[model samples]
Target: MHLPKNAHVALVDGENFVVMRNGGAPLEPKLDRSEKPDLSASNYSAGVKHQDDAGQALGRTDLEELAHGAAAAAWLNAKAVAGEIDDILVIADPKTLGEMRRHYHTELEKRLVGEIAKTLTGEPTKRIEQIIADA
Candidate 1:
């Protein structure tokens, strides 16, 4: 898809965040991935000991954090559904970004909700301004 006529911003953060903007800059500046699950031994054992079935209580905090990160990227696009913007291209990391391109055959058949055009990844923060030059 063609880039929107309106200037767009693709934002990325140090905590591994991805967001896109068109028609207007993103209002959310700081990435908020601070909400993480506490995976202390005491915390995990407490629920298992009492309920014996906390389901997923055995999971580690790192796993939960990564899942939240992916969800956060999806949420940004959901917020933009009403706008006239073409679409956004959000990339979490080099690996996922590469994966998206490599599995294009499979992804193309199923993925269409978010950005439509192929996009450059790796920290949208630095490249946000360069989009115009690149385009």
Candidate 2:
């Protein structure tokens, strides 16, 4: 698919995310993973009890990772709201995409134009652009 000129593409996964602007110049990273540390399950679980109101043990690993992904989505949302981006194309794994959908603000939801349900966080910019263009 041909992306709109200057469309913002957000490549995200549970651990990291990067926002790229598609333009005459090569895809340049607007926001990168440098802001957040690479966190492990142990880091998020330390001192945090994984239980429900009934004290039943609950799985928090995925949930914690989802929250991190949502946080990355929120950052993109803020940028969109600020008019820093015109449109959005989200490329992420199914789970991260679901989390992004769940946590998106109303304004950001309206700005979304495309989605690719695959993990491409570590893919090179040219490769990602080719994949999207061919999609």
Candidate 3:
């Protein structure tokens, strides 16, 4: 798995992202965003919640999680189209990675070099590089 000389990598999670270029030091993302879940959503409301005999909610959804994935995908799309990045490596947790895959534009999809299903947003750059190298 040889990395392209100037390939870009993004370490992403539900709430944050850190972008880096392969041949250079890691840098702060040009576009960084964090979103709070909508408190008005039914899930957060004080209603008699439905539950099975086991007292489990039928399902769960998070707006903040969705927002983070969308923002990251949008940023990647913009950078790829602007020629700021040619190749891309994405490191994210399984769910966020799935969301990113769902939201990626065709152009950005073509630029994807690799996807690592692991959360690395809080990792230092040196550790990230080593992980990429090891992978």
Give the clashing pairs for model 3: none
Per-residue lDDT tens digits of candidate 2, residues 59-125? 4346566666667777877777888767888899887787778667778888887899999988876
Error of 2 at 29 (Å): 14
TM-scores for all candidates? Answer: 0.34, 0.71, 0.71
Model 3 agreement with the true structure over 1-135: per-residue lDDT tens digits: 456766777777777777766664333222222222222122222112322434334334454665577678878888788877788888998877877787788889889988999988777666777777767
Off by over 4 Å in 3: 24-60
Query: lDDT at 89 for candidate 1?
Result: 46
Tell me how candidate 2 scores on lDDT.
Answer: 0.68
Tens-place lDDT per residue, model 1, 10-118, is 3322234443444433332222222222222221222222343343476422333333333443343343453422344443344333323332333232323233233
Q: Between prediction 1 and prediction 2, which has the larger lDDT?
A: 2
Q: Least lDDT summed over 10 consecutive residues: which range in candidate 2?
A: 26-35
lDDT of 1: 0.35
lDDT winner: 2
